[model samples]
Target: MASSLLKTYKKFKWLPFGNWLFSKAICKRAPYFATIKPKVTHLSSGRICAEMPNRRAVHNHIGTVHAIAQCNLAELCAGVVTDATVPNHTHRWIPKGMTVQYLKKADSDLKAQAQIPLPREWKDKEDLIVPVEVFNSDGVKVFHADITMYITEKS
Candidate 1:
């Protein structure tokens, strides 16, 4: 099992599937991150770019990645931003709606990015549109999902 994991790790450094390594552990076995996984490839307060592979389980009958999978990535992309924007104890965030556009077929791995640049006029009750960019392994834009998250008082 360890050898196989080493093989997979060698094959894809982005394994340990679903959610950022700093967030949580999803899969605990070989190809450990074969499940839903996210790796923060780049990050900033206003922007964050992550990567997650298009595994077989996420593919539909057409052998392409499922739209839901893309949605999940979009959500995750926004979610990570909350960690920095809201902080661990001060605020909480949840998905309000998803406006997604499937621009092309995803035949390879994928990268999901969410840019949360705080607007100058951002009111206390402002809703945020986390612009998530999804790219295929070839670095082609495959999908785009704007996930809105409403932040409010936590009780």
Candidate 2:
């Protein structure tokens, strides 16, 4: 059975600008993510892609995308992809911790992709690591994050 988020995506993914609207709806639910103004470009069972514009709002004092903004984009992709892939109603997940590396200065708009292998079977509890990579407009990998999610059966 598909998660509600996945079902919703399937329902609207073919519509014009549906992906953009879906991203906006997610930002509305998690208002803090609106800070980065993320645009989710692709979403599927085990992979997700998103973009963060390089605007003054997300710029650092050095005139590049702030480190935290990239982190935000990573978390957004990880969380949403996990939510969309995991079995819904029976399980819940939350961020346990994050380990990140700033490979290079992010000077332009950034794109992020998160990926993980689908579990063969859901367990009672598990710590899932979702890896996310962020690239600049020129396609240079500028940031990376391994977000740990604590998932448990909803009793």
Candidate 3:
């Protein structure tokens, strides 16, 4: 389950091409995520961090990073953190909803951080809110997301 996955990630993340390979696998599950070219910078039980470059592929007409692209990064961070934190044998998590705010123009590479409390128990169904913050290269907050993840026991 997630514990084993986390262990695997920890073992390989330090390898030369580990992070890139992990991102590639993630993109296979969610193809649009590949468009942003996300790179996971950190991961742990309750936290995750990732970055996306300010490339032409992610640019908006105004030359800033597109809003949806930021959202995608936020979701990616939140989902990874949730997957690592939630116990995998009994529960699985899926993004159910999100509320986002664009605080400033993101004209540079973006970094996203997501955090959630480690769940102590799982119900038949529950909604857990994971908060993610995105920062521009200058360390200014550019976007924020409160993503609601639906958790359920495996049938």
Top-TM-score structure, candidate number:
2
What is the per-residue lDDT of model 3 for residues 42-153, given as tens digits with 9 covering 90 to 100?
8888888898999999999999999999999999998888888988888888989999999999999999999876656667699989999999999999999999999998
Which of 1 and 2 is ahead in TM-score? 2
Q: For model 2, what is the error of residue 121's alpha carbon versus the real structure, in angstroms, after optimal superposition?
A: 2.5
Q: What would the per-residue lDDT of candidate 2 be over residues 1-155, giving only the tens digit for each residue?
A: 77888788777778899888888889999999999998888888888999889999989899999989989999999999999877887889999999999999999989899987976577777999999999999999999999999989999
Model 1 C-alpha lDDT per residue in residues 76-143, reported as the tens digit of each score: 66765654455324345666888999999887889877877674333345477888889998879999
Instruction: In candidate 3, list every pair of residues with a backbone clash.
Output: none
Regions more than 4 Å wrong, model 3: none
lDDT of 1 at 105: 89
Q: What TM-score fits each model?
A: 0.71, 0.96, 0.92
Candidate 3 is scored at a TM of: 0.92
- lDDT against true structure, model 3: 0.89
Q: Pick the candidate with the highest lDDT.
A: 2
- Each candidate's lDDT (Cα)? 0.65, 0.90, 0.89
Ranking by TM-score: 2, 3, 1
